[model samples]
Target: MVWGRKKKRGGRKEPVFGGVAASLAELRLNPLDRITVADDKPASRAAPRKAAGPGGDGSRERKPSQNRKGRKGRARKRTRGRLSRLFYWGAVLALWGGIAIVGVVVYVGAHLPPIQSLEIPKRPPTIKIVGADGSVLATRGEMAGSNVSLKDLPPYLPKAFIAIEDRRFYSHYGVDPIGILRAAVTNVLHMGVSQGGSTLTQQLAKNLFLTQERTLERKLQEVELALWLERKHTKAQILELYLNRVYFGSGAYGVEAAAQKYFGKPAKDVTLAEAAMLAGLVKSPSRLAPNRNPEGAEARAKVVLAAMADAHFITEQQARAATTRPSYAVKPVGAGTINYVADWVGEVLDDLVGQVDQNIVVETTIDPKLQSVAEAALIDELAAKSVKFNVSQGALVAMTPDGAIRAMVGGRNYGDSQFNRAVMAKRQPGSAFKPFVYLTAIEAGLTPETIRQDAPLDIKGWRPENYGHEYFGAVTLTQALAMSLNTVAVRLGLEVGPVNVVRTAHRLGITSKLEPNASIALGTSEVSPLELVGAYAPFANGGYAANPHIVDRIRTVDGNKLLYARAQAAPGRVIDPRSVAMMNTMMEQTLISGTARKAGIPGWTAAGKTGTSQDFRDAWFVGYTAKLVTGVWLGNDDNSPTRKATGGGLPVEVWTRFMRTAHEGMQPEPIPGTQRGGPLPDIAQLGRQVIAPAPAAPASVGGPPQPVRANVRPEAASGLDGWLVDRLFGGR
Candidate 1:
């Protein structure tokens, strides 16, 4: 019975093995039973187990044992199935977590603030210095127009800008989503962030209201503001603001300023080529300042023109024409104190309009042509003698007798330094002061024909010497003045009183303080060049002194009358008209036959005086034509004596050169109240003449011609001759 039972289990186990083999075969797997059998070790173990099983029937016993082994294999397979399911679910969770992280990163990036927006003020453009004929000279302030509506902007302008700067402006909603995605992809591929994807609105926002900080927070703020602006304002308004607020270098702060600065024209008048050039400046202002880098600016303009053609804003031919258009012409700004005349005008304005920041156009009396001539003359003279005298500085001032300063040069080169010697410097007038002394003497009853001795004179222990240290015994007052004889001037000053001379100088507009001593007769008093010119103008204007002035009128930019420059009341007569006439006559002699004769020009009446200060520190020539009065002062800044500089050397040379050019094409007029007459004729024909027929009467030899006293002279006659000689040749 046991054997039969064992056989039954064996049969069942065999079928089980056979079934497993068949399943393995269907699964195309290597069979474990075959493998174990081929290894032979498993076969031997199986044989032992089968032998011990079921009443020593090995096959029957092995059947039960195989069943147990199969069960264990099935249990192990079920456990592995659970682990596989767990692994699959874990992998799905990890993938979703990664996706969440990426989403967070993208969200943060999109929200970051923009890095570069700053707002600047909007101001109206300033008009530059245009010649009376409409040529520009210099420009001031930025120019800008009111913001235009979106529909008002030319479509081509915005379209061209977009083609170059930002193409996705309208569709991006202030932040470019695709641009961000592309940047992200690029960063991933290259392992670095290397691109900026700012949309137009973002760029506008940055320009309007942000700093250039490369921070995420600022970027987000920029995006928010850009969106806000796009929704609130039209596209044209944004563009207008951008154009007006952009910097174009050359001290220009807007499109209009840039246009005027570079092209010497207004923004509304700019050509397409000029517009492109201005637009190109948006990228680099200093590098392309119209005055600094004109070549680079032109090349950049061509690039902009090419871009315009590519965007179809213009045809290729149009682009070529625009690029070929001549660069806008501009005049260089005057170097230093370009508005020097304007500054003097400002001083007059202070009395008219008070201190205010209003735009004012002052019509001045300055003749630009004369001004140029005067400047050139002074510069040329200084340059020519720079090595000889080591004199590198000088000043020239020309004015109408009515005190209108027509032309002035404050220094040799205004570009080098700006110390206005013509107006601000105060130095000894030297012999220029003698005119006041002579005027005083004339007021005290002296005349040009009066005799004065040009001998050494003692004035309260102040011994005045002639310039050449040699004295003439006797000379006319006019001759003494023409010679600038120091001794004669001291004697005349003592006779007239130094106080009276100072007072007379003040009356004539000398205004500067004078020394109270007799030395003042030799021009020891310090006076400014302007004061000296103004003072001498009385001689030119026939004894009346007109206050020096620059501004004629001031008006607002809108043609509103701000201030009218009516002539101020004249100062009282400083000297008698006759004294002024006589003084002018003597000065005319100075130009014709005196120390300042070099200043004489043909057919022009110029009366001036030469002055060399003590130690040769300052040299001066104060003179005037019938129309103009000019003063020149040459000296060292440190008061060191010039080596060979004198009033007659370069000062008179400059004066003559300047006057020749300044008065060119202008008719010469005689000074008012001047007497026109030649010198007195010789007196040889005054006495009666005897007939030749009277020779027959010589035989008579009647009365020995009244016993003509041999070697016997009348006391009265000798005393009279001596007195006349002393008065004519010893008083000076």
Candidate 2:
């Protein structure tokens, strides 16, 4: 219409170019433009196109070709819509999966301890047992050897563990992906879980923080902690921690302790063969220990050596040579007896320092040389006679006059029984307890010269008899004690009132309970060898109270703080000097002419008591010199009687054996209250030499008993018996 100048009729038609009042909208750039010339506005909605049919009826109609095209177009649109729906759901699933993954990560992280608070727990603190001269006797608590740094170990040692435990330990992160994959493949092929994929770091994480639980969650946590360890510590540090804290077996922990326990050497000194053996122990510590299963241990070590060779840590030739070398558990010297001392120290540890939170060093009073000597004496003597005597166990303890334990042999073989007989087993002292009774009597106005009947006597149906069942009609107090006449001891206990005897025993350091009765004088009451020896200490140390003690001082490993120390208080005087002199003078006769004659020391003045418990169930000898006190006991642990084994037999023999060696380097100190105290005279030099017999004396003797001394001048004696003792016996 515009082309036709629809307009010719448009009344004046808006002038050709729309002059004065015309709008710019009337302009059209092209024929397809919808701008109108008359109204100058955009057109309204278009009406549907209609096909003309049969004389302008304005009805719509379709052609066959158009219908076919429309059908194909609808099919194409349907296909495009299907593809869009597929893509939209796929994206939704992917987003949900991502969210799930984030949730799992957050959930696992929540189970962990705070990262800032993460810490490797301190291992059970090791208590080092040191001898008096500063040599390590043993470590009491956790390890035999002290802690050692990785740098101190031989390079091959750590490499051996690495070769067998984790081949790629140094190359990978804590959780090894390649190792895990290999293990997975292996497990799949076997159709079961046959191998573990834990790296050394992972194992450390499990040991330090996690329970030994097998679960999906725990494994994930382990992996996370391992990764943290890898980030926080160097590879070497992680390896060191793993090595030092891992258990090897046989009551040992740490490589250093393992080395000392199994090889009797330090980790730094272990050979290649030993290193391989130790490394193999990690796989099956209890089952593959060299001590328990040497064959298994050696076979595993061979595998480890082969692995080392394959890893280039060692040559094939070297590995083969190592296989030829023997690497087995070595038993430490005195393992049996020395452990008794260690156990005693362990019991005292808590008392000394509340709780052992850190490593500590305990300086004990044990003398290594003396300890060895004492053990040998007890063990060897028992070995020679136990079968013949029908005895199964024995114990011995040696101490200074001040009650410092120098040596302790708790049993014949600690491996067979860890029972500490020396400090724990309580048995009748028998006649050995008569000394306390006699000491009490001497304090109650009796003397070595005071006479008492040794005949059988009865007190409330309790009849006491002598060793041979033969009683002397009348014997001096010294004679009765030296002879260990049971009747005389009972009579004295009753005369002095058994309560006083009990008091004397307790005051002298007998910790065991005592029955204040007639039988108490015969040592019917039970007492430990430790207390017996400790009680005897007063007699040896000039009547001072001596409480038995083994520990000298306890301090931290670094020796900075003192946790416990033996107080240096002056000893309490438990007995007056007169009573001590009489007691010493009387008991010394037992070593010279009484029950313990065989237990004599050649160069020193010695005194002791021999005891044979009821039915010979227990035999004991508690002996002392001026400086040392030692006690020995032998019996069956079940309290069975022996084959007539008396205290004077095996116990005396063992005591003599130990005392002879103990006195070799010691200066001879005379018995107390002796004016001419010095080196004892050699008895062999005076064999059968005739001396004037002692003159029979008064029925009732008076005055202080003669002092037992060496090299006494005959004229210096106040009586004939004293002079004869000086000349013939050289002062007991």
Candidate 3:
């Protein structure tokens, strides 16, 4: 319209700028520019007229508005179709997913026990053995400590676990959806399941009601049980239960037990760093146990502290302090083979406390200090000398003269083996059996002065020979016993009958079966170290038979009700006073100049016998003082012979080490019915004289005696002189 001035005559001519304004408005810079100029003709007609060529025809111009409407209609139809298809497939997939989830839940739930009937099972009974001085020796069975509450634990303790195990524990209902989602994303990124999303409640539910099987079914059941637990108990109670029921390593099954096992303290007393170390054990108890893997445990504890800081439960400074502060666990006082004493106590629990169905405490005769010494001495000896002697294992058993076992070491390493070589293994005692043989002969009217032919002897086709195969012709019985002469023992066994020797051993406390053959004199019969030590007690305890008891008292842990207390009474006399004296005299000589001379305990009068089985399969030193009876055995478990490991070697060394420690502060006592003095009696000189006729009453010292034999040598010493000399310096 501006190109040719609009027919302006009477109608005021449209301003030329009017068209410019319209054009400016129509030059749409954005969608909001919809201004138009007024005209008499229709706007469509005006547009055609403006775009028409000089011929005044508008056919050549294109109309974009109509075409835009049709194209938009087609696009609307396609979008609607796409939305319909997407909705249909989404609904189909959702249905299948729901069905699959329901099927899994049902299948897993069906395999579980009835929910109504489920209950937490009772833990195995724990036998707590205490030492004679009231210190804890060891624990047997499940080492379940006293129950601990999460509230009582240090605040940082529970927080540490929460941060590392389930950070959203308080906010989550039962199972954490956010945690599971995050774990899923992390696992996807790692291409494996490296993190666990189980909540504390979930772990508790599994430990209480389910087996630890890594199956989808078990996981589903765990979720269901977690929900049930949440409904049944508060979060505090659930956490307490979890802490009290979770297992740590080293036979410990509770937070308290783990605390004691690792830090040697109770959970309530655990330090912040200690608590972190214990809390880190949840992932892999055995692998991360502080006592077992301190480095791994420390590494894990640092992770926990870092997590705690991230959760705002601990400050960055606190985390740094904890990380730098090394965490160490003080090993329990008697943790190793000292457990052998605990094992023995558990075995006898049923007899000591009838129907041991609940937690009970057993007061054992073990002296914790002595037990430690014995274990150290035995373990150290074996480690140092066992290889050299071709010995693989050893055992030690020590007891009071009254049969109260003070210490017992069953093996070199309890973790390597728990076979209880001290109380269970039945190995030959070797020449240690000669004591009973001599005792029997003494009872059968023989004296230490009796002359025994040490030459070769054959009994029932068994030709017993001396250790060196060298026989000293006409040796006194004391010399024969001191030398551990196998031939002399065989002769005496044949003279007294093997049956009587067996009777003597049984009367003294040998419970194992004994063979009555002539070989029995050489300890062909197998017996445990416990029984052998016990049987030797009569010589040390003034002829009293030791029962070899361990448990002194038993009582309920909670109620303090007495289950059993050892009845105090005089020990039964197993032998005559004269026989005990004779046995002591003969055995004492062993410590002075015999095979067991290496086993002497300085400043104390001690007596014992050394035994080396045929082929060196077993080496033993059963020695004792007036205060203690100790037996040591060194050998191979498979009964393979050692490299000439005679009883005078490793076994004696171990016995000496242990006995020296055991009698550290004890007062010395002379051998019963004997005196320490100058020289030993010349028994060989007395052999030249015949015995005088015996008086019916006790013979007076320094008195002339009647002669029973016709040929009496004038040069021979009198019986009183011989007796005095023999008693004064017998051992030397």
lDDT of 1 at 126: 46
Error of 3 at 152 (Å): 4.5
Please list all clashing residue pairs in model 3, or write none if there are none.
692-706, 692-707, 693-706, 693-707, 693-708
User: Model 1 clash tally?
Assistant: 20
The lDDT for every candidate, in the order shown, is 0.68, 0.81, 0.80
lDDT of 3: 0.80
lDDT, residue 244, candidate 1: 60
User: lDDT tens string, model 1, 474-562?
Assistant: 55677778767776777788777888988988888888778767688888878888889998998888788778876555566677665
Where does the lowest 10-residue lDDT sum fall in candidate 2?
692-701
- Between prediction 2 and prediction 3, which has the larger TM-score? 3
Query: What TM-score does each of the candidates earn?
Result: 0.61, 0.72, 0.73
TM-score of 1: 0.61
Per-structure clash totals for the candidates: 20, 1, 5
lDDT digits (tens) for residues 423-481 of candidate 3: 99999999988999999989989888888656554344556666654445566898888
Kindly indicate the candidate among 1 and 3 with the higher lDDT: 3
